[model samples]
Target chain A: MKTIKNGIFNENPTFVLMLGLCPTLAVTNTFEGAYVMGLCVLTVLLITNFIVSIIKKLIPENVKIPVYILLITTAVTALDLLLKQYVPALHETLGIYLPLIAVNCIVLGRALSVASVSSVGKSLLDAIGIGLGFTLSLSLLGLFREVLGANTITVMDGISSFTGYHAVFQVFPENSIIPMTIFQKPAGAFLTLGLFLAFFNYIKEKRGAAK
Target chain B: MSLFQLFITSMLTENIVLTKFLGICPFIGTSKKESGAIGMGISVTVVIVLSSIITYLLYNYVLVPTNTTYLKTLLFVLVIASTVQLLERIIKHHFKQLDHLLGIFLPLIATNCAVLGTTLLNVNNGYSFIEMIVFSLGSGLGFALVIYIFSTIRERMEFANIPKCFKGAPIALITASIMALVFSRFF
Candidate 1:
């Protein structure tokens, strides 16, 4: 429970650690896209942590980085192909990002930092915690961007075909008011991220003062 | 697209850093100083060109023949990591000044998404040999150009008054956001 809280709040990947900024910025243009990307990262993180922990003892100290890279790339590639086959829409939305996950820093960072030194059970717990942290941050960022930029929040779409339903919630009717179109652009991503980082910093400072 | 157009497009209109957002980690982390940013950019340019050519050949010959395109990610990353390591050693022995300039950034280039992203984009786009060369060159130049400009601005920003909370990364990112807005106008 502490591990999970540490990942989700104390060491939040997006706000605190800032490990995987590229995907966080890229996919958060839409709620659904960001949600899927977060879930994908979570899956990759969990599996990679589990396997790296199991093989940590076997890997030689000299070749650890390269070995970890190989493991991560393999996992990312397998996940990429699996998504392509089963969830083609999400796959298309992710595009090159799916492949780029091989170097997402967060995944490899955990493998090196936590999994390599910890027991399998501990690593798995850490992975779950970090994954949840990343997912929540990504989703929140996406929600802000999508709501402000497009006045709508997309929870699910074509993926619903598999489950026989579609989901989208419009915050305001079309033409109701001018949406801040900037929130949908690359610039908006940076601005939104910067603001959130500042907000988190302010909170941390306040808590420290109280302490 | 013509070779010239492709070069300009990749370098300016579709910049790997500002537009595509492939290598923001190094762009932010290393762009604090002008000299370091230049060193990092040149090192990344060298790695991207070398790795792209090598990965392209491997993809075409080894992966294609074996019907294992799925392994491209694994193989390309390995090639990139080894290439960075080899380049570091060769530079350390042969070019002391260059090695000193690049310092630790040479090895970090192996993990920079821009390097792998360029190679993968080349393969996925089915670029001809000449086109691949031009694209890689353009992408590297684009990265160098953006980081160079950004670092210069950041150096000046040191003297300017910034808010307490936005002193470091927040200001840098806001600057990047404005730059992205400016760069987007070109396209």
Candidate 2:
């Protein structure tokens, strides 16, 4: 329970720790995209944590990390297949990024950290909490990206459009916004993250001063 | 093209650090001191080259036929992490002086995305084992090259007066973008 609590709000992976920014910035362009990807990680983390927990002691200490990794790949593989068959379009937008998730520092970080610490159930809860924390942060980033970057709040494009109050996401009418286009590219992701980091620090300073 | 061409291109035309943007965390944090930068470069270069070769072989011989290529990412990380573990042990035993110098930076190899990036790139790019070795070396060297250069600039930066807001990561990132822009011109 404490592990779970630490993973979510107390020691949040994204905002507080700033550990897994790669995928968080890359995929947060849309709400649904963020949700789907976050859910995928959630599923992977939970299953991997549970499986690794029971066998944690059986594996030699020297080989534990590799063994954990092998266990994770199985979960990722299964996830990749499931996404492809059911949500075909998301399967496309995600593209290589999905496989790239295996290298994501967060998933592996959780697997190693939680597995080394707690009970099977405790690990399972930790995976869930962290997974949810990751999902929440990603969804927020997606919302910010979706509203500011584009004029529309699109979900799956041609399949359907979740419209109304959507177009307001654009800060400016078609030609008015320069797009700060950098924000939309990989470099923009960094710049946005950097600026926000400054903003977060500023807020923290103010709060601490108040105390 | 010739092997020389591939090697040359990997270093310049397609530098791993500036172009790929794989290992920014260390590039920013460790580039404050020149000697640390150089040590990091050499250590990372050795790890990248060695690990990629092993991962390439493992993929071809074991994972592919077993239909477990999906497991490559997990497997590669394990290999790299354990190898790094061994590297720390060897450094402690064999090269006490150098190890003392590189003491803190040693285990960081596990965290550097460049190392993981290389092993994954070799498998994904399907470089022949030879090409894998060359690419790994070139990438590592390119990484080493950039970090060393950045640290030299930062060494001078210590003497310069900088603004309050843009002191650490911000200044480092702006420097990175500039370097990246310059590197992009080559490609």
How would you encode candidate 1's per-residue C-alpha lDDT over A31-109 as one tens digit per residue? 9888888888889999999999999999999999888888888889989988888778878888888889899999999
User: What DockQ number belongs to candidate 2?
Assistant: 0.26
Q: In terms of TM-score, which candidate is strongest?
A: 1
**What lDDT tens digits, residue by residue, belong to model 1 across residues B1-82?**
9999999999987889887888999998999999999998898899999999999999999999999999898998889989
Off by over 4 Å in 1: none
Candidate 2, which segments miss by more than 4 Å at Cα? A1-9, A25-36, A52-66, A84-104, A111-115, A119-122, A142-154, A157-172, B1-21, B65-67, B85-106, B152-167, B185-187
lDDT score, residue B122, model 1?
98
Cα lDDT, model 2, residue B86: 86
Candidate 1: residue A194 lDDT (0-100)? 87
- The lDDT per prediction is 0.90, 0.73
